[model samples]
Target: MPSMFGRTTKKLVKEIGDQELRPVKCLVSATKIRRFSLIQRKKARSRFWQLPDVPLDVSLMHILEPGSSVPDAAVEVSADFSDTEVMKQQAAGSVNAGAEAGFSEETAVCRGSSLEYQIVSTPHETWTELQKRKLPDPEPYFLKQCREAGVNLYVVTETVELRNSPVLQDHSSMNISGKFSIPLNIFVKGEGQGGGLKVREKKLTVPKGSVVAYKRKQLVFKEKDWGIHHIAEDDDQETFPAGRVQKALGLGADFKLLQEEVSQKVKAAELSKDMQNIVFSNLLAMLGDREALQDLMDKLEQEPFGHLDGPGGTILTELQKDSCYSGVVSKCLILYLLETLMVLSDIQHVLLAQSMEKRILLPQRDLVRSILEPNFNCSENTPFTLQPELLAPLQGEALAITYGLLDECGLKMELNSPRSTWDPEAKEPLCALYGALSVLSQLAEA
Candidate 1:
């Protein structure tokens, strides 16, 4: 190193010594692109997004103050705060306990879990009033069983809930039926305190003169000396449901069309029901059980069902695929007839198995109606040919069957002309099929 004349200084100054930004020699080498050292195991604990594990011996919340054994803990924010606004406290344990702040008994819930909120809502702090988050006391599991046993939960006709709700019915009924038109609370027979699934509408038919257990909804009312006032929910507030906010701002006209379009789409999705059938009755009955259904299916796979070079072969293949694809099982004597019906006119493969899922019990007519568009025209005098032997099988089944209209006198169908829609006197292809089923049911009974 050549020094100019006398000497060169050993130190450099003013370089990188500003605002604690001075560079230093590496304890660890500089990372190559993203390939750095692996994350440490313990660093996840300090993250705000991670919920800290509760101590086995203590509560996660500081619910119990230092020396209070009985838990006389009370907390209140400075204002009503446009509903309970949970801003993190800059200073903890700073309570204005001297001023005796007022809040409803429900606010105790808000005070306890507001710190670790599972959910936060604005229109209503709905969960703040709940004691705990769990299934509702009147669960749907038992109700479904009751429905299967020919009992239904019935209540006052005028009760309107915005969504599907399980009205609590009396579980302790001595018989399947209970007294009708009883007060809702009496119908329920027990009072419960909990939260669970929400209610929506389902189809329930209440028979005339039949007994039903009364069902009651969970409702809150504040009974004051002046009157029994209903605590109504202001859910329709803001710019959406009530539309008052939009009207006030003079933008209602602009948004009305958009709102209508949105409403239509939402309603369509909600109302739509999947139209598919699961159980094909004839095969299941013949096989004796679902286990046999599989055994027969395996046998058919191995033996190939006696030279299926015809339409029957195609039907068998489709049936096998359908059975395998769905959680439900279905099968055939009428496969050839189905082929014929299809050849003569347009028909949905209602007899075939579903690729994904099918409704357990879709009537043949419903399956047909699914594909029948509004402008769909029916084929007149649609020729249908059936093996005369099928009639004998239908008669056998109709006799064996004891329930439904098949057993009644004068149940008849004629295949003169078929249409897309049903008429009281018009005959169609389904008439023969149903007529056959009726005969089978009757013969089985005999």
Candidate 2:
């Protein structure tokens, strides 16, 4: 039995040796050994902290120095051992060298083109030194251009009261407020390239209340034109209509036959002989009597013809009373006498003289009113009929008076007469003459 047991054990040992041995079971598992190995690695890693290598030889003073250059140092390190390991070691050595030279891993791998830099310094200079530099003069060029273009610049200093402002249905004349300005330059265009050229520039302030006349953008100075002198003053002086009659009769060169002509015209009219004689005698008396003229002037001075009331207590009184000329004769007769007086050359001379003496400009309507007050005692539309025989002589006489006045004032310029001239400065006298003649013409036609 012992022999058989020994053989059996040997066979079993051989079988066991020939076949794979089975692992023995334990209380601890394979999973537990792996978990313990991982724990040990974590603890070893946490025990020691890794830090970036810094060079001890480099000093802070060397880095802060201006215009200083530092040389880059190279390092080599490798762990791989193979046939291709040399190439890998070479790359690793380059990376380590770049890192030691203060370059990041990304910057070392991805190299870019070299960059260049320039340094600039701050400037130090005073503003006064900069302004002292030479500059071009512009005043000469500006004044030259002004001279070439004949441009004038005037500053208006004052504005005075306006006269003869336009009324409804009246377009012949307009008087704007006086605009005064002192000329800064008087530039006249040269004749024949540069003949008779004068440029005067004076800086002067116009006196207060000095009237200016603006015509077509040109300034009219009173000292240059005598006609405008009347416009520069206020209208306060009274005009004497009888003075016109007295002058006409006293200077009877052409007026000696004026009474005879008027008488002949009145005798041929469709009026009674007595009415003609009455009209004739009253006109003669007005011409001969100086006291009558003085009385009329006193009455005119006391109250303007326009402000007088009629006999019937109303403006439109049928039977005239308390009037200077209305109670003398019929309205037709008064109209005839007015026509006769308005035609006198002496009347024009007297009016012009008075205007100059008083330095006052009278309107044409006022001039007409001085001769004959409107018959407020009649209807507003009442018509006064003069003898048809009298119309021609009256119109001719009015024309003669107008031309005479224009000539006496030295305003007759054939084609460029002051009578035809229109401007704000000359408007005063021009309007007066035009208005008076226009009324007389209308009366003669009526």
Candidate 3:
């Protein structure tokens, strides 16, 4: 291009400078936005919150030295913090440690890996005295478990001093009561621990029994020490229900108001026997001991049985027929009833089936049929009518109670013309008839 206009180029070069004119050619280009570039990382930040705040500087000095073994370490700050006074205490002895020299928002970074800490405490002659012994690295150990199990560890340090300024009067037992204020340092670590991370601490009152065991992801609140009592053998005749059922039953509706008011009232009365048996059965289930079940079965058998009015017959009858109570039985009728009802109740279908065949020595088909059979049914030999012929032999009040119970159980039946088809609407009086007879039998037996 300069060749086409040599005179213009020469004139321009001469006006500017010879040296500048010698390097005239140039190239230019444009680029789109390139936002990111790769670089090596020097420090890494924690992906989650930092560990709880502990006075490691003050406490570690007494137990661990600076040259401790560690690998792959990092630190980050968290929003959690400790009491200002505790910060001061920790800072006093934190000069030589890696701790920050002054008060800052940066808290301890949790070491991610598990740190093995040994127990170092001042020994005492008595176990109670051990409570007073200052523990080394107690906060760290407690905090480590808290983080691993995902819980909170609260530390409270209380000082107890024996004062000798009391007046010794002629009193057998002296009672000194007064209000005094003492400082308490509460350190609440963040929910978790490991790599030294941000720790949150708070100041609060220490309630008795607040501390609990953290095991298998469970937090058990501390319990008072009541004297231990061994569970009595089922045969000992001392088995007692915990009374939850009895409490539930006693709170049931009032029945006397039902007659005139036709209002809501509990149709069923609380059976002391049923509640006791259920509670006993629950306790046995918790034990999960086959031996315990067998023991209960043996105890149940040995228990006396007579008429319903007798001392132990009702309870014995209930227990004897509960398939849950498994053991040797001199009579097969009780076992058969238990095995059949358990299946029908859907409590343990498979287990009951296997038990009936293998343990109780009954055919599976028969047991299943017995369970499926309706509680009340027409005589198989007769047509559809109030089948009083098929009803279990009951007399007087027993018959009345039987009818009432069946009615409550939803077995509505009707006694129609013997020659005509049975209508359920006509069955109400027939039910009343049987109810009277059943009740009479029960009253006589009672």
Best by lDDT: 2
Error of 3 at 173 (Å): 65
Off by over 4 Å in 1: 1-208, 211-371, 374-414, 418-446
Candidate-wise lDDT, in order: 0.21, 0.24, 0.23
TM-score of each: 0.15, 0.19, 0.16
Per-residue alpha-carbon lDDT of candidate 3 for residues 173-206, written as tens digits (9 for 90 to 100): 1111122111011121122112232233222222
lDDT of 1 by residue, 1-446 (tens): 11110000001001212221111111111111011011101111111111111111111112112331332222211211011212221111101222222211111011110111011111212212221222233433433332233221211111111111212111121111222221121112222223222222222222221111111111111121011012322211221111232111222222233224323322332211211111233332332132333334333434334334333344355555543323122232232122222221111122222101222122322222222222123333233322233322222112112111211211222221121233322222233233223222222221
The TM-score of candidate 1 is 0.15
Worst 10 residues of 1 by lDDT: 4-13
C-alpha root-mean-square deviation, each candidate: 34.0, 57.1, 38.5
Candidate 1 vs candidate 3, lDDT winner: 3
Where model 2 places Cα greater than 4 Å from the true spot, the runs are: 1-294, 300-401, 415-426, 438-446
Per-residue error for 144 in candidate 2, Å, reads: 64
Instruction: Pick out the ten consecutive residues of candidate 3 with the lowest summed lDDT.
Output: 26-35
